[model samples]
Target: MDSLKKKEQTLKSSCTTSQFCFFCTMKEPDSPQRRAGLANCFKQMPLTDDQENVLVSSGLFHIAMAQPDDPEFPSLGIFECMASLIQKGVNDEMWLRRDQNIYIPYYAAHIIGSYTMNKVEFAEKAVESGVIPPLMELLRGNKMSWVEQRVAVRALGHLASYERTFEALSTYEEEVVRLAMDLASTCVDVVYDNFVGVKDTRRRAKYQCDLLTRGVGGFEMENCKAEEWTSQLQCWSLYLLNCFAYKERSLNLICEEGFLRNLCGMWGGLANHVSPAGVGLIRILCYSKYGRKKVAELNEVVESLCNLSRSSDDWQYMGIDCLLLLLKDTDTRYKVIDIAFFFLVDLVEIKDLGDRSNFGEAIIKVLLLDYHKQNKVKLINISSSKARKAVEDLWDWNVERRRKERAMSDEKLEERRVLVGLIKQQASRLYCLGEIEEATRKYSEALALCPLSLRKERMVLYSNRARCRLLLEDPSSAIRDSTRALCLSTPANSHRKSLWRRSQAYDMKGLAKESLMDCIMFIKYGCIKSDQDQTATKPRSGVKIPYYAARMISKQMDATWLFATARSRIKESDNQCGNDEGQYYREEIMMRKMMDNRGLSTIREEPLVVKEDINRRKVERARRISKRATSQIGLPHDVGVAEIQCGGPTKRDRYSKFSSSDFISF
Candidate 1:
């Protein structure tokens, strides 16, 4: 006891500041006496105007709590030190007047956030220490800096993870909901404003600048710093919304307050950070029946989502989910089916359906549910044998010939051609709907019955058949059919559909030379197929279609070349270019080098040496692109489309109506 007393005296004599005293005192041996001594020391320390000293003391308290089992440590005392920092930071009139020591509350928030992590018991104790009020206060508008606001909301998010803190947060539910809505509205406004007057050269220029530097909101370059702060605030705000979205009360409040409207309005154009969280929130709320109805009632919402699903790959899954849920309602099924069926068919063709192959099942449900809604005669039940028979009869080769025989004149040949056209149309629909085998059979039947006079129609059948064969994994047959269609074409570029399909077939068969040539021709011809129905929908009206088409062709072309080059480099590094494979590969590589092109979504991983070589080539390509872009457009060129900048939740102006009362001061 005498030696311990001497050690304590020596530690106290060496302490130069309250921060040092706080740590030196905590370093004592474990005992009830030590806990009492630490508490008394904290209480005796004068309130230093030095924000760093108080912040450091809070840091020491957090460290002490790291070992909860230490008998000398007291969780309650540590929380008190953190709470004291909060009280001093907020209540200190001089610091508040000068705004000099705001980091005190910021660090206090960090301590509270860290203490609550994976420790539910500490959360309950911290709540009892009046930590919630200060954390909540920091989230209020005009109460703290952007960084501080983000830290506070993040701390609350951690606290809200615990059942106790979540309940405590619910007590202040109205303010929290309002804040979340405000942040959501800001994000929505940013995206919507991006499309406003987009045709105006100035707005388009500003939009581009915003995407690159996030400075378009004020048209000043320095606002880029504000952009980061805004992005962080928006992220955490969505997080807070996700935390609050689980309960029925919060769900109702969110829906009642226009969160759905903002979410739907921005679905077409959300920033990278906000899109995932926004979609997640929509998915969560749509899980409820009332939420589903609210969404279904908003025709514009449905329209935006359908448009988004068609254009953006990022939101397709969630868009499909929300569509499926809305389709469950009998009254809305037909309307949704009309808008969604086309893209859903497209999605079914490319994406792995996994268990959600019920996409087809859902269509079946919609057909059944809306059987009486249409004024026309209801079609045969999709599942019944009669429907199967009708489908078979429609595609049967003999049935069309029999109908033609009844004409008994030269007109009968024309009738045969008409019957062939009908069969081809049905086959095209089946192929798009992902019934590949059946569509192939129908296409063959149509071709067999087609008269020589219907030469154009025959070419289309061959092209359609080629697509089915490609999807069905018969590359050789697909190539043959596509080649046949190309040979019988009406004009130079009129066979683009056949050409592109043949390219895909060549790619599948590892015939990269043939594929690259076809892709180049497709791009040369505006990238749209001759068949009107087969063309991809334009993302926006009045935008040139060829630009996007060229972009896609470029991407696929690069993908093919990368695969070919990497394989050749690995297998035939020193081979002469006289061979069929080597000649084509060498020419294409030369073409790429001259154009200084780089690939997106390359075909396969390369060996380390090949990978390094490709990377060096890519860097050189990018440099060339940058220089060319500057010369031509005067703006930095991004290969991908630039996203719009949405202000994050921390934008001060959005929540400026709320005063300091909204934040916790105690």
Candidate 2:
């Protein structure tokens, strides 16, 4: 127990010393307590790379979580201390050579790579300062284990993703590509050697070979083929060749070099390994620039794919997508569609009626419209047995979906009812308090909860809310809601209220002429029903008086020509019967009295027929002028009269003074 106590005290003291050293050397004191606490904790624990990583990660987290609002945060200091530790550990020769300490440098590299603060610069500095040499050396070493290589390779890939490292590595592109290829090649060879003749290893080697061939142009399939190569390798070879053909589009490489022939050869040997995805890739390559020149070779490959697509029941859907992509160019569209149509016809006759019917529907929907529209194919002879079955199946599915939807809608309706009731209650309260804006908002919320199918009720709610919006001086929203209300309303349901609300909204928006028309309609349709009800309730003796009174009221408020005539008559009557003229008639002698009484008569004068004829002539002239102004005369709408006629003489013969030659000169 005493020996353990002494060892613990020594560990605690060493950690304290390290903390003090970091603070002194790094000159950052922000997370000194956290650092000290972690160090002391480590003293009581076994020192493993994971435990050290926990401390390192804790430090990084503290730095990352520091906020700009906290004046006393030492995030920069923490990052500096962590960076220093990583640099020192990676650079230390003793640490790098120690077998047990290998994990330290590896973890350090990981930390450097993942650090959020200027990570790219830090990684570059580490690499440029030769800190990554040992790791790279281990990666290239013959005695290096597979696990170590995997780690190194992953780390390098991560580093390469960074822009700075990518730019730096671009200068040595050939070297980098060669190194990556060699590592992948070595991995492939090792897998093959270890497994002897195992199919799985051959498969793994094929995958590695594919990766190696990514940017390496000259590394072809012949160099990688071995006696142990399985169908998997052939698939990979086909993939690599397709990729190369895709990049260069070299007809020579595609045909003369036997790229498509080799790819097609693999179809028989590796049909199972070469799936629809692989086939699709080959299809794309064959339609590429280089592949287009080698039409015969391209056709052979496409024919092989089409055959596989037709024969393989497993991946036929993928084959359809490949056919669609290949047919995107106009040149191949008709031909590809023809082939696809044949396949679809075959699908219609398939033994599994359900799948056949479903596929038939999909093919018709995806292809028929395009084929018929572009190629003028009638599809008159197409099989209807599968199509009819598909439609029935689709109808059944729709019925089920609609049934579920109705049930969901019922639940939503119940929820909406409760929400609308709450909104209405709130709106009533707000309305009482003279908060019209808030009241209108609540009313709008209530209306929005109403189902669209209930047009009559929704129109009422929308019209009412629109009025409230208009009162709140929000004419745009008012107009929108009012318009919606009118659209929802039916002729049988009476849209007068909606029209009235819209008229109010339009009036508020400075559209008085439009508003007047709507208001007149509202008074004519909406008020007539109420007046009739009132007349029905009234005694028979009072009916005539009320009817006459309603007619007078209608004349005053209506926007028709009758109202204009009434207004003109009122203006004439007021002008003739002055107060002086009325009294003068009473006091005058016989002849003068007769003249005065004629002008100031109590009875209203009917408009003279001659005056009416003159007014009619003026209205007709105005209409003619308006029509002429609006009619097109080979000029744009913005062109002025001067621009249109260029100072032409009037039709009243103003040009009679001038000869045709003088007019032309002018």
Candidate 3:
């Protein structure tokens, strides 16, 4: 242990020249090494009276100088060390010194404020022994400098948070309250007098009011007649009243009689002094139930705020935020909305250039939702339509601006491509969820973000979006996108597919003949004309394209007209020839026509056509048997058969004939 003490001493002496301490090197003295060293040193020699005095004075000096880098730096930890030293009776003489500057004791008391848990006993002993009295005396002294007063008041507030200290102070509650009130009153006076000639008197007054409110509120005055007493003080009084009225206890007291009315009037007069956009005063007025009764006066004040809001275009944003508070009360909601509407519309129309679009839209959405809930249908519809048009216009403007921007920036083009891809994915999910309108919006956004360089991708997006729009019953937009997709097609696999989609859009819009023309083109270019053998009896691979393209063309097919024309075309070809080859050709043509009519263009000719033909013949044979059986059952031939007819009795009919006899015999 002695060796450890010597080693500690060596570390400390080495630290002295290094302009730091051994404890400072460890970052935290609570660390095992630092704590062990401190304990060992304490047990080894203990601090002599002179050494303790030196350490305390050095700690105090460093704290005063705000030198946290010093080895004996005065921090909360250092204060804990001092309290430990005092508790151990290391140096009672220095601890009890009166002329050592009240800062030392005041700081020590302030430090004690943090000791609410186990340090109550230590605090009680210190107060009982008169260590706290000197600090109190310094706090109440008129000659204390501002810095000293701030420190003392903060320390008192801290100590007041403790249960025992606060309870003990409760015995002298009246006296403490009177002292605090007096100090607050004097502090307000000093601030007014000192700041009277200042250029920024308003700001100075606010700060002074804040300080006084904090000081008085910290005392927790029970019988303090703050309201009646504060009525005569103009700027500072109104400020403090506003502050206190927000406090629960003070609000309970101030709401009686005509106190809230008079307070509201004073706040209005001081409102100009407060930052116009700053709602601190407005918020305080709106706090209590009593303030609700003075809606007219509040409205007047809010109306006057429009001037401040109009002072600068930027002020309009802040103005809207302030107006939102007034509208929060159901009674005043409509009045505030009406007053704010004109300003909002003007902001949107005139300042639609920058961030105003978002702000305007936000405010309009709130008003519309509220008005709609109140069943004001006309107002709701008007606002909704107006907002929708505004949003659409803003969207177009943004798209045009971004288009221009991308033209100037290659980096922006890449970013736009990535964004478009993400939007397309989200659009697909939304479409799957049956949110057609939202999906259409997302698809439009994707198209706007897509660069012209990605023409193939852009074409696919347009085609998909056209499908969504058509599902939404927006045929005009669907046709527009489809046309754009066809125009923008490139050599990618989806180009001819876009033509088929455009054909579907045309058919949906009642342009069937135009759609048929596109289908023929799709067949010529999109489909492969295999020359191997048109009359082959085996299945073969047909042209491969996207499924959506196939579906689209199938949807556009004029089933009655196309079927008749295909059958006639096949018969005419067969009539122009005379052999088994012509018959086979006719069969192949009929099969191709069948697959095309069913929108199954992927089927090959050789085996699949033969299998499908055999299935078709079996189906025809079954129909004939069903017709013959229905005739034999004496049912009208015009009536469709309802059961399978294999020229045998049904199980239900046969069982009905023998059920009783068979059961008895068994």
Best by lDDT: 1
Q: Compare candidates 1 and 2 on TM-score and give the better one.
A: 1
Q: After superposition on all CA atoms, how large is the RMSD of candidate 1?
A: 20.6
Highest TM-score against the true fold, candidate? 1
Better of 1 and 3 by lDDT: 1
Number of colliding residue pairs in each model: 4, 0, 7
CA lDDT, every model vs. true structure: 0.52, 0.41, 0.42
lDDT of 2 at 247: 46
lDDT by residue (1-666, candidate 1, tens digit) is 233234435554575555435556556687665676677655543254542344344445446347433433235365666667666666675774442244456556766666676678777877887777777676774545445566677667777777777898888888887776676556323422332212233644332333334233332222232333444556667677877775655766777635676665332111122345556677666777766766766766675565434322344567767776776665555445555544343332121232344343453344344343332244332334444343343323223544555555777777888899899888755544445678889999998887644657878888878876765668767866775565456542247777667666666665543455565556434322332234456432111222223333444544433222223334443433333443344333333332232121111111111111121122233334334444554432111101001001111311345343222110
Candidate 2 structure quality by residue, lDDT tens digits, 360-476: 345435543433323434433334545434434434433454465466666787776667767877865554444556767787788656553455666666766765565555766
- Worst lDDT window (10 residues) for model 2? 607-616
Q: Which ten-residue region of model 3 has the weakest summed lDDT?
A: 607-616
Q: Over the stretch 1-666, how does candidate 3's per-residue lDDT look in tens digits?
A: 233235445554554433224334444546666655444433332243322233333334334345323332221244444344333332244444433222233334434433322345544543444334444554565443332344344444444545566555445444444444344434433422343212233544332332334224321120011221222233333333343434422444434334433322332111122322123434554554455335324555565444323222223344455555555566555555555544343332122323444454554455444443235453442334555454444444444554676566778777888899899889766554445568778988987777756766877788777666555556556655655565454321124554455465555566543454455445545554332255267665444433333333334333312122223433344334342343343333433443454343433322111111111123244345444544455332211221122111232332344332211110
Q: Between which residue pairs do clashes occur in model 1?
A: 133-664, 137-663, 137-664, 234-649
TM-score of 1: 0.48
